[model samples]
Target: MDRPKPCDLVLTLSLSRGRYGVRFAQDPAEVLAAQSLRHRAFFSRTGQSNASALDVDAFDSTARHVIIFDLASADLVACYRVQFLEGAEIAQAYSAQFYDLTALADFPGILMELGRFCLHPEHHDPDILRLAWAAMAHLVDQAGVSLLFGCSSFLGADPLRHAAAIGHLSARIAPPDRLARAKTADRVALNAFAGMGTAAEAMAGTPALLRTYLGMGAWVSDHAVVDRTMDTVHVLTGVEIAKIPPARAKALRQIVTDCLGYNNTVSAMH
Candidate 1:
């Protein structure tokens, strides 16, 4: 795999009305800015004041950090941590800390795990989200990743509180049966929602980040695990990029072009 190039170039992306930019965090301070953004979004909302003021973990060392910045305000609006899974290192992957990926045991290609995804609550413009995903598509191409997987979180840890969304994913959204199981002792069974949760309700409780994953034809696990530290309920989610519909691929390619500039390789965009 090619080593990720360090970048600090300020990108300007054109929009129908305004503009935004995407940049890879090139230093610890920039990464810390991303962490602070996450800390602000996840902690304050969840009332987890006791947790550290920064959202961080060991994965930050091994992961590549991507951030979307508002060119107008020059503030980091969103962030995601992506790690390439390799060799015995798979045992230490961030997702492995919560779910069982044994089903991918036979898969023989590069896989990237994405995590620490969050957007500043005050910034809800879809352009920021588009920039983040475009950066991700670039990362996936550069690393030659065939599969992208990670944990997508909801506001709170209580499964019943997220029953509608959980049920919807279990009912109609899933990875191949072999790859979507969560192996937690406290995992709530999706079947437990029979006759209770509805798809509409599920959509109501689902977070925007997870919703994006679902739209990409990603699948979720059978259950969500309560994360006390983060004060959120999250499930394992994965998408096979090769399986994305052509139209979706085209949309991502255009976004990357707008965000990263048209000079990017056409093969990478595809």
Candidate 2:
């Protein structure tokens, strides 16, 4: 697969729902807005409140940033970054930094690595989450992305704090042995807590974003990386597009189709 330009992976499209709009970052300011939101969401507890409190890394330059904003206030409410990769390009993915995903490097299909997904500390509207998924669905279809992978984070650096949630992933959606390996020096084996909690307790403890992935038949790595720099424990998660349930896929596509139709109709009227 030849390398595509950064612009090629981004679609010239914008989606709106209620008072929020979703669009790919078009300039540094927009991308910085996303970084700012991520900083607040991820680093508030660490007191990184200097003027340069933006959460940024090398991957930011190579990936596309998706920003969800309030139409009325023009405030970025939620954001995430995605990097498109062919099987051969798996090593360049953000998740690759923490997990040994060499197994997926030979997998046949395009993959998208989603990272730094977060909502504004003050924005709690459920529609924000819905809009995020809708935008992702559109991107997946447009790019022909066959799989989606990322590190789903838990709030603390301690795995025991999220034992039930990690255990649930271990018991229900642990990836096959061929997918990922525990490469991070600071990592906890998920299976150690697989039987520590009940399914109900597990679901309650799981993060919302991860729960959404699991609902779509996603799976996770065998261990969780204890990222002390970020003060979070995370497991590599992957969702094979083909393995998603038919009903769930339909619902996601319906969101994309409806958003497109609504936007087109509104455009035509003007």
TM-score of each: 0.83, 0.92
Task: Compose the digit string of candidate 1's lDDT tens values, residues 3-99.
Answer: 4432222232222213556666777778888888889888887666443578788888877777776665667778888777754455667888887
Q: Model 2: per-residue lDDT, tens digit, 73-133? A: 7788899999888866888888888988888987666788899999988889877887899
Model 1: residues with Cα > 4 Å off, grouped in runs: 1-18, 49-52, 172-177, 180-182, 262-270
- Candidate 2, residue 263: Cα displacement in angstroms equals 4.7
Per-residue error (Å), model 2, residue 165: 1.0
lDDT against true structure, model 2: 0.83
In model 2, residue pairs whose N, Cα or C atoms come closer than 3 Å (at least 3 residues apart or on different chains), thus clashing, are none
Query: What C-alpha lDDT do the candidate models reach, one value each?
Result: 0.71, 0.83
